[model samples]
Target: MKKVILFAVVLFGALIKAQDKTDSQFKYLEYDIEKIQNLYRNNKVTVKEVVEAYFKRINDIDKNGIQLNSVITTNPDAIKIADSLDHLDSKFKNKPLFGIPVLLKDNIDTHDKMPNTAGSLALKNSFPLQDSYLVKKLRDAGAVIIGKTNLSEWANFRGEKSTSGWSGLGGLTKNPYILNRNTCGSSAGSGAAISSNLGIIAIGTETNGSIVCPSSFNGIVGLKPTVGLISRQGIIPISSSQDTPGPMARTVKDIAISLGTMAGEDKNDKKTIGNTPFLHKDYTQFLTLTGLKGKRFGYVKGITKGANKKVDDLFLQTLKILEAQGATIVEIEKDWISPEISKNSFELMVSEFKDDLNDYLKSLGKNAAIKNIDELIAFNKNNKEELQYFGQEYLEISAKSNGKKDKNYKKAVTIAQKGSQQGIDSVIKKYNLDAIIAPTTAEAWKTDLKNGDNYENFYSSSSPAAIAGYPSITLPMGYINELPIGISFFAGKWEEGKLINMAYTFEQINPQRKVPQFLKE
Candidate 1:
């Protein structure tokens, strides 16, 4: 009788202990950098405690409950790093992003135990020897590198018919809003993880729609900074002309905070030379609620053609909100993106992909699983896991392409850059506009691995900004049937501050962001 009683007592105590460890309060704690800093300032939470809470949330919600599969691998040294930060002098506490946890898309090199696979099984064991330029910047700012997030395999550049968020090694990263819905990639995991509050902030690299599209679908703020604003030194390549790493976060202010820390010139990446004059150490000064007042915005009407009627209705409603906020709306015709530019853009990417990817692989030394596109194609064919959902047709096409030295490639680059830049420049000059506004993307489509992505009635304004190598910011605008949609603000080169101001203003007024319910559709 005594033994039975003792056993019952021990079981009850164990259950209570487990409940304390996975406390529900910590699970949904809003760990935004500002909130976290406030807590730290008040001595309410230590950096180690914050890191532990995030880990607990990841274990409970990400690993077990909804099984987001967003995180590829967590840093084993995260707690240790946080502990060291906790011991920092009070003077160092004022540093931006001090002790905040950050996740990076798997494509960005980290020179740590985690391999920079870009969601490919081929490079699953390949560890980088040096951190990427941005990673070094984040670390210097006292950000606790928590983990790497899954991304679309090869940033969705490997295959013709590919599903966003599906990776050979990391598997499929599901939308947090609705479990069955897709999180658009190749920054899908970064979008979903940040939306689900798995981490405070995440970094996602974009060649085109990779950052903004996923951010829209997953309902977060994603900033695709100007091509030169952030270095692309160690990121896996799709197109050297378009690829850029940017911040994904729950709020525009957080995006602004991250940008201040990350935006700087790198000696290794020549493109960053343009950023020298424009870089600002603190972007939060531009976060004004009155930013939209008296600002002139050009509305791009052409891209709304294939959008859902309800989404278009929301867009119209948003226009009214902007007008109410004292902004002048100028309707611009959709004559900017010419067919020739669109056609040449793909050719440019193919040429750049072959050239850039080979160079990236060469940086990995002789032991890289697949050193070049030809070897990558061969390896994908041999690996059943890689081809289970889609074939690497894009890889084969890129492999057969003439390198960047081709005259056709050079022509494509000039045409693409000139056309896209003129597209935005013409509209801005014509209207004397501050920035252009358009729907970031359609709602999150259903995840379909068998037929690849079911992109139904989807149109995006990302192309113009992407091709121009300019800056664009996407923030939550509204929702349709529980799926979130975002509105994008894009402008010319080195105009990220203006875009950020406009986005932050809109965000403050609208405040349409909602936490995902993890519906199991």
Candidate 2:
């Protein structure tokens, strides 16, 4: 009788202990960087405890509950790093991103146990020889890299009609807002993960609309910095001129904090050589309540109208708010880049991709899974899964090209740069405007495998900035049927400071960010 009573008592105590442990882990869950840091300072939590909470949340919401499928593979060394961080006094000193957890888009290389697959089965087990330049910056600033997130395979440069978030190695990543809706590539995972609070912040690479489009779809903030602002040395490329890694987070302040750490000179990448003068040591210094008070913004009447009424209506409402905030909005209809110039810029991307991808593959050394584009195309032909959804028509076209050696490559570069760069500069200078504002893109599309990426109106202004290698920011404007739409603020080169101040002001005056419920269709 006594033995039975003792067993019952012990079991009851054990259950109570487990409950307390769970509560401790969750007390600081779903917090932003500032809040998390405050919790750490108050001795309310440790870095390891916070990391464990994120892991639990990821497993519950991402892997099983709603099945977000955002994370590709988590780092084995995350907990160990957290432990090391906790051992120090003045944990926040000199570490701007001290103990913050981040998720990286799969293409960015990390030399750790985690493979930088870029969502291809051919390179599923491919580990980078060294950390990418930005990854090194993150680690140095004391941010813990938790995992690599799924991206559009080859950063969505693979197929003629490629599905955004579908990859051969890491299957489909579902939209957190509505499970069936698409998360735009190739930063799809970073955007979705940040939306679902899988990590406090995420880093995603962009060539054109990759950062802003996903951010708009997922209800987050993303910044595509001036091309030379961040290093492109270690990142897998789409176009050397257009490709840039940017930050995405729930709040504009968080991205500002991250950008400060990410920007610097990369000796290997020549674009960043003379970039020191343009770089700001602390981007958060620009955030102010009255940033947009004296600024002039340009908008086109035809761009956001007549497509989807809800998106247009929301954009119209946004304009009223900007006007009320002491800023003047100007009409600049028919001022954007022409179709022919845009087409030529695209051809340049195709030309650059072959040389860039081959260079990256060769850097992987002797034991890489796929040697070059030829091997990748051959592998795709043999593998059923790689060709299951879409045909690799883009790869075939790129493979036959002579890259920069071709007669038209230099001409294409000149036309693309001259048209895009001048297009933005002329407009900004003509009207004496601070920046250009437009709808980021149409709302999230339904994820379809048979027919890929059908859009309603498909309005986007990312190309001008992208082709020009300029800076742009996208933040949540409003939602249509529980789907988020974003508004963009873009300007000529090295205007990131002014852009951040403007975006922060807009977000502050009228914040529309909403948390995803992971609803099923």
Candidate 3:
């Protein structure tokens, strides 16, 4: 009896110690990609253990504690894949993203059991026939697809007055900072999950503010790369002219590391072919603490005026930091994106969306839930949950459009391309500027279940970059009323390297981002 009691006590103590160790990993959640890799090198944590810990965090924080609802589905094979990575051959040991677990927005297809629902119930069981080009690249770079994230249904182009983070399938993704606040749209889960430390990195697709807005609201670093930098081969379509997947993480360093692996020409995306010259095999080489020195950045006017005055105050403080770091800040007029350009860009996207969407759905073969935009609209009408909050106005409009072959599409694309690209080009040339800096978007607004997105009263600097297909980076500047505000650096096509360098320097200097409080609001 004494021996048995002793054995039981010993086992209980060991379990308590183990629980304590796991509980102490709150700090571990803030670790960047490089730190996690370092932990792997030192054998302090195995890849399997790392993934398991994230699973715990997701269950406790995302699904249970406050129910962030950021993750739509977790990869069932993540642990098995991580274990295999732990036993990888010597040649595969040094891969850039070896053993790193990443989350993909649900819109991006994965051949694995996980479905690419794009946060819609209609295709909740739809798995891709193959991995997306970006996923293929990430997998090759030693990254593991740990799961798919919740996103704005149809990437927020589905309907009129649609809420940013609400989806028919995954529910609404709340801001990590304040549980009642929004996570912005489209890439909503990527931003929330990264900020909440659910995953080390995530991929978010953007046709406009989707990537940066979520990142800004969640207080993380997000990059919307040049349209061709990352292939859109298996992603659910939005605007073919504007859509591209980009990396989201807590630090700019991880962004650079991830970008290197994802950038390459692919036969599936012909736009990538012409941009191959701009692709860097290793982008981390461009990162430097002194990168801000001797660089000229144009600061756009009226961005801070878009919303809270506190953000404007923060922007001014950032300008002082930039000058102190040896950067020349020049005030640039906000004429780079005109109303005419915005109108034309929207027209082109409407047509391209119908055409591009049909192509992706057809690519899924006969098992696809619904075949085209027309079917999608009809599905929403029949399913009450799909229209519980908003109507599919955009899908209806796209169904009525003539598609890419339409004369209006050609005219819109031509004008949108020439006007937007040239507008940004002419300004940069005149000012001899390396990039244009502005507020990424307003601080996140309160999530509205009935009225939909409340960003109309807020400022957003995403259109110029999105329409022109330029690269842009948004990083935490500071916070306003506990919500984070982000500063953006965007410029000509293929300037991702320059943007990374500058954003990294600012990040290191300011370092304002902090883990969310999950405030009850």
Candidate 4:
């Protein structure tokens, strides 16, 4: 017994020593927004060096030290892109994200040499013919396209019992702060990679809580802009009404900058019309630490009755911070809002997912996997590893849906729009609130492949914003254990500027963002 105890103690000590060494080896792992900016300003780090550091980190931690499985494929043109950016910077450093390395969730199309596979082998070697509007914007801003990150296969829309971050092509993307914990879907890799310092920032697409949930789980900032604020063109779609790509970054400022660059009208997406006014060429102008003053936030504490005690406590602490920051807090009345509309949003998603996805697949040209909803159902049945972990119960449910024409779907949509919009718009009109505040979700629970997600109470605060075609942003408030919980601020359609100001205010007052320490037991 003494010998066994002695061996255990020695082994534990060795493990601690090794972890310290690993942590020290990566100096740029936990860089702040200003620190990286300063490094760029002073020429202490070249674009090539920064991109190379991330690549080396990916090679070491992603494939070696931790085997995070966060990335699907490294960009073949990364070095060339970096070199070209260096020359451009030498002549004129006009680009905002000049030389900064950014990762893409596999669902976002890139016309580069790298293929955009949404973590499915079904799209292997199937590169799109054109760059997404967001991709073009990133290039224009002089950002380096580093690699594609792993995601929940088909963006977590395919299955009911699906794992949040698992992809057959790229495997599971482990949370950087805690290896055993989940990185939440469907933008799991984008969140995990940013949290792990694998990239400066990443872009993620959301239909429902895809961006915000993963951001909350991974302890980062996720911006789910107004439906038409960012173009859905070239993005693998779940719902055209709900699907919009936005930035995931370690800081609100970084997220703002990326969003500003990415927001614009696209010929491919007609819905983006009249978005030019919302697209600020300089979103950084709104980032002020003192912006929290005189702001009104609608607190949805009613949703927290059944939440985790630890998460609730953290949330209360966040409320205190907001109060101290000179913001007005008002409790949401139960009668003003109900859960019925939130439930109906999912029904609308199911019907739209079928129709919207088929159109997207057809746009992908020949040699693409399953071109329509029926074909997708068949393909999932054929692929065991991809479909086995999570049965396509939702897809099957969606298959039964009659696109947009079903009377049931129409009723669901009408109820959703009326119920959610009435609840939100009435409150906003009555109180004249700048934004409504609520928890993005309860802190992420442990990942369970066998049983699926353990979602507690999340107010579905985003549903009103999503259905209303408005904007929402989730920022890390505090943590429950090592897991991060986020506070969301939402506003009505075309009110992105107001939402950004409010979110920026809260972010400045509460700078509780921290790098996760991955402690292995």
The models' CA-based lDDT, in order, is: 0.85, 0.83, 0.84, 0.76
Which number leads on lDDT?
1
State TM-scores per candidate. Answer: 0.94, 0.94, 0.94, 0.92
Off by over 4 Å in 3: 1-27
What lDDT score is found at residue 162 in candidate 2? 73
lDDT of candidate 4 over 312-335, digit per residue (tens): 677778878888988888776656
Question: After superposition, which runs of candidate 4 have C-alpha atoms over 4 Å from their true positions?
Answer: 1-20, 32-34, 89-91, 455-460
Model 2, residue 112: displacement in angstroms?
Answer: 0.3
Model 3: residue 268 alpha-carbon error in angstroms: 1.0
lDDT of 2 by residue, 1-521 (tens): 00000000011111111011332345554578898888778888899988988888778767876678999999899999998999877845348889899999999999899998879888988988999999999999989999989988888888766778889988999888777788988798999999888899999999888898889889999999999999987888888878999999999999899999999999978889999999998999988886788789998886754666666678888999999998899988585676666677777877888999999998899988888888999999999998999988778878888886767888888888778898888888888899999888767777877776664455666788888889999999998767788999999899899989999999998999987766655
Instruction: For residues 446-517, write the lDDT of model 1, one tens digit per residue.
Output: 777998776445566788888889999999999887789899998888988888889998999889998877
Model 3 per-residue lDDT tens digits across residues 1-521: 00000000001111111112333566566888889888888878889988988989888878887788999999999999999999977678689999888999999989999999989999988988998888989999999899989998988888777888889999989887877778887899999999988999999999888898899989999999999988889999888888989999999999999999999888989888877788898999878987688989897655655445666778888889999999999998866667888788888888999999999999999988899888888888899989988998778877898898777998999888788888889889999998888877666776777987753455677887788889999999987767788999988999899899989888888798887877764
Which ten residues in a row are the worst by lDDT in model 3?
1-10
